[model samples]
Target: MSGGILEGDRNMGLIRAQLRRQRVLAGMNQDEFGKRTNYSASTVSAVETGTRAMDTPFAARADEVLETGGLFVSLLELARRDGQPRWFRPWLDAERAADQLRCYQPTLVPGLLQTEAYARAVIRCDDKLTDAQVEQRLAARMDRQSILNKDEPPQFVVVLDEIVIRRVDEAFHQALADQVHRLIELAERPNISIHIVPADIAIHVSLTGPFILAKTADGGWVGNLENQLGGIVVDKDDALATLLSRWETVRNEALSRRQSTELMKEVVKSWT
Candidate 1:
């Protein structure tokens, strides 16, 4: 296996050992621990055996039940951190402190805007993950949305290719409809804006791939390119400038907020 995959497995093994030790320290059997975490005994056993990945919710609940004072939560974060590519870590850090975020997606809906079911569907596309691992990742993704709820949330703007809305599968039709409505609701927030790039757009810089530009609280700018394998943080001044220019060009090609909302409404109706 690849080094990255091996590292992830090692981290998960450590997490499982820690979880099992903590449960023992609490004088709880698998069934008892399962009761606290709202999971079945078999599920708890699976996590302890490293056959299932432990999710954020499970960590929080376990920490509370075992009175570990967030130890499990920390371990869960560690496992997640280990699983991510090194290059993507900086972008995750920058996102938390960003004063403004601008993103352009040509394929899937941006993670921050996805609903729970939608997020689960996206994560499940990774066939390597066990059902438990998928749930773990899904919970983590959902937790990231808390950033949007901050009192002084970042000003966020997303420009999505029109195909993103039109490419719904039948199984997720209702969920996707809810997601469109969610976009509309989020757009009503003063700090958020959502735009759509018409499918017939003659040309655009965003055709290259999905990218995010974040303006940090201290005024520094960070650019990130996300791909299937991993992510890259573009920090060089020359590269940042080029990405910013492309962002402006793509933003210009996107429909206005009102028009995008109208189009979203139309799409939602078709899903019915």
Candidate 2:
């Protein structure tokens, strides 16, 4: 096999091992495990054999049915962070394994869809990272985009605060415009849904920060919170529920897809 395909197989192997070990410990067979995860026996076998990738929804179901202590869920985070930026591993891992990725960003576009130029500008502005570190971080961010192309890629749902469109600085205006245009193009894909949360909307749960809600292959749900220094992964059921409720409200408040695309086009035009 070619190098890229080989690497994918190896990565899937790690996840398969993680699941197989836990399932055996729990004393369950493929069919029993499949039933719990809402997958067919063949699908489970394929996942175990590295022929397929498990997304968050299935991961969460597997976790619940196997009664594992977030093993399947944690592996996804680990995989994302592997051989890349250390600080971002937790969130990245969750992103790769997510069956459904729901994001609420008040200040900018989510990382997955960010264009290279826009990502570079954002990284450069970070006073904390050295120049080389910024470049490295940018590369890592770009690499994360591959998750959107994996077999059975996770469903991505993102909400952008309208202010993000208006907040570009003079220094990065051109790059930001390119980024917005890139976003509009990417949003046209079937797997991605982009929503704009109007600036005028009433306050909601995610106002204080950005967060991601991801499900594991075993039916486990995890909520991720990030800041300038570090991030926390929330696994407690109550916390996940609260985050989900907040996300639902935000989703409700955001503009529809058609409206968002039209708004995006208008924003991009202003830069030209």
Model 2 stretches astray by more than 4 angstroms: 1-88
> Any runs in candidate 1 off by more than 4 Å, and if so which?
126-136
Clashes of each: 0, 21
lDDT for each residue of candidate 1 in 70-188, tens digit (9 for 90 to 100): 98888777666666657766887888889899999999899999988888888888898767667656766776787899999999999999999888777978878888889989999
What is the TM-score of each predicted model, taking all chains together? 0.88, 0.67
Error of model 2, residue 244, in angstroms: 0.4
Could you give me the TM-score of model 1 versus the true structure? 0.88
Instruction: Give the winner by lDDT.
Output: 1
Query: lDDT for every model?
Result: 0.85, 0.77
Return the top candidate by TM-score: 1
Clashing residue pairs found in predicted model 1: none
